[model samples]
Target: MTTWVLLRGLAREARHWGGFPDKLRCALPAGDTVVALDLPGNGALWRERSPARVEDMVAAARRTLAGVPHTPPYALVALSLGGMVALQWALEHREEVRGCVLINSSLGRFSPFWRRLRPASYATLLRLLAPGRAAIDRERAILRLTSNLPLAEGTQQAWTAYALEAPVSRGNALRQLKAAALFRAPAAAPGVPLLLVASERDRLVSVECSRAMARHWGAPLRVHPAAGHDLALDDPGWLAGLVADWKTRVS
Candidate 1:
């Protein structure tokens, strides 16, 4: 049985994983466990100042995981900025990380700035960073950029409530962005089995970036036909199946 530590992207809390965590847990082999930990300055820790570097974020993640009763050789399943943190963690703590599954994530060393962040979303990202925006509007904009699914009214309402309940400060948001932009993955991939899952139609980050990284690492790359950046949101079952299959092959 393995300990699967799940991580989310900027300003997104563990709750943002929606039903995916449950799905993955059910799909995993017997006795395996899934745990989602909030990065500093998001969700339960919204008041904390987020670090401006991915390495520090990795340290924060390690601290959060210290309390979980999990065994070593942990499997890391992380998306976007969380994937960046996972990469750094795997590189620095090879003894603890067994393997990594990165979803729609980009590293500065492999991708150009425009590809790491699509130029088309520049205005949307800037608007998301603006101060004093209503919670509902901000969440709606985020949904638009992250998922291809037509959000149900209930989903939007729920996200609005989540955002209002645990608002991320503008400062923390900027710090997270800085951390992502500054993160530079090593030229060589981490010394662990890796699986790369990406959305071919991702708008926030280019799919080519994932393809390039997979090529560099000689890791298997699975492409979703139409999902956006939030591949889990768009197709949870498919994501789970792919992950389960990868686990089987690795095991």
Candidate 2:
């Protein structure tokens, strides 16, 4: 059985993936398994201090996965900051990773800072730092910045609940940001197979980041015509289908 590891980005936790994991599980082969992991200082690991380096994040993730009953040589599906960690993992432990799929991810060496994280999102990101901001408002602002399509009716409420249940401290948030900012992927691609997925209408991060990485790595890229940075949330069925197809070809 192939084990699929799902990693979310930034201050987001596994719960933020919502129904996407289930959708992917169904889309993959029946015996395949999906595991969603929370990075340090997020979700179930909220009390932990976030590492300032992406490599440390990879180490922490490996520690967490050691507890799970999964086989080696897993497929990694990561988004945003988690993508950096995934890249590091593949580089550090080539034998343990079979393939990687990065969604809306950017590297420092690939694109400019403005393109990596669009200026349009700076205000919302800054406002989120204000004290006493309600969870619903924070989640709403994030949704507005990251999603191009309308979400489910209670998406705000559910995300707010996630925020309240496992709040990521501001310090941890900054640490994670630092990790992302400092990370620089190798000029050469990792030895394993890679797939880069991007959104043409992303508001938070420029699609060019993925485009540039794909060109540099000579990896295959699939662009969503209307999705946002949160491609899985915007069009999970499509993402699932694309992954299913790619996995079939690579496997």
Candidate 3:
């Protein structure tokens, strides 16, 4: 069975994956196991201090994977900043990472900052930078920016609970953002197979970043014509389908 290690983006944890894991399982070949891990200062590791550097975050992910009982040759599936971590891991530990699937992810070394994070999102993002905001309101704002799909009141309520239960402190969130900004990928792409997925309608991250990154890396790009930045949440079926197809081709 192939092992898939899933990682979420800035200020988000494993629980944020919602029903996407199961959707991926259904799409992939049978017996493939999916494991979602939380970075420090998020989810299960809420109280821990998050690393301010991307490489250190990669080290922490390595440690977390080492402690878990799993087979070797993991496929890293990550979104946004987590995608940055996955890219680093694949390059640093080539033998351990068989492939990577990057979603709405950008690299400082490849794209400009404005494209990595769109200028349109600046005002909303700045408001979220400070602490003391109500959990529900924060989730609502996140929902608006990240996903185009309509979220039910109950879903927002659940997200609020997750936000409250293992809050990513404003300080940690900014630190993570700093790490993402500082991370510069190698001039040459890693040798491992990579599949890049992007959402055309993404509001937070410009889709052009992914397109240009794919062009530079020589990786295949799959565009979800109308999804938002949170492609998994906006259209998990399409995302999972593309991943499964890519996996089959790579295998």
Candidate 3: residue 165 lDDT (0-100): 84
Using lDDT as the yardstick, the better of models 1 and 3 is 1
> Which whole-number lDDT from 0 to 100 does residue 28 have in model 1?
90
**Total backbone collisions, model 2:** 0
Q: Give me the candidate number with maximum lDDT.
A: 2
Residue lDDT tens for model 3, 136-215: 78888888899987653476778889988888887888889889889999879998999999999999998998998898
TM-score of predicted model 3?
Answer: 0.96
Tens digits of per-residue lDDT for model 1, 72-179? 778999999999999999999999998999999998888899999998888777655655547777788888988997653477788777787888888898999999
Give the candidate order by descending lDDT.
2, 1, 3
- Every candidate's lDDT: 0.89, 0.91, 0.88
User: In candidate 2, which residue pairs get closer than 3 Å at backbone N, Cα or C atoms, i.e. clash?
Assistant: none
Per-residue CA lDDT of model 2 for 1-251, tens digit only, reads: 78999999999999888778999999999999999999999999988999999999999999998998897889999999988999999999999999999999999999999998888798887654543446678888999999998796787889888888888888888899899988998899999999999999999889999999999999999999999999988899999999989999997
Candidate 1 residue pairs in backbone clash: none
Using all chains and alpha carbons, the TM-scores for the candidates as numbered come to 0.96, 0.98, 0.96
Against the true structure, candidate 1 reaches a TM-score of 0.96
Best by TM-score: 2
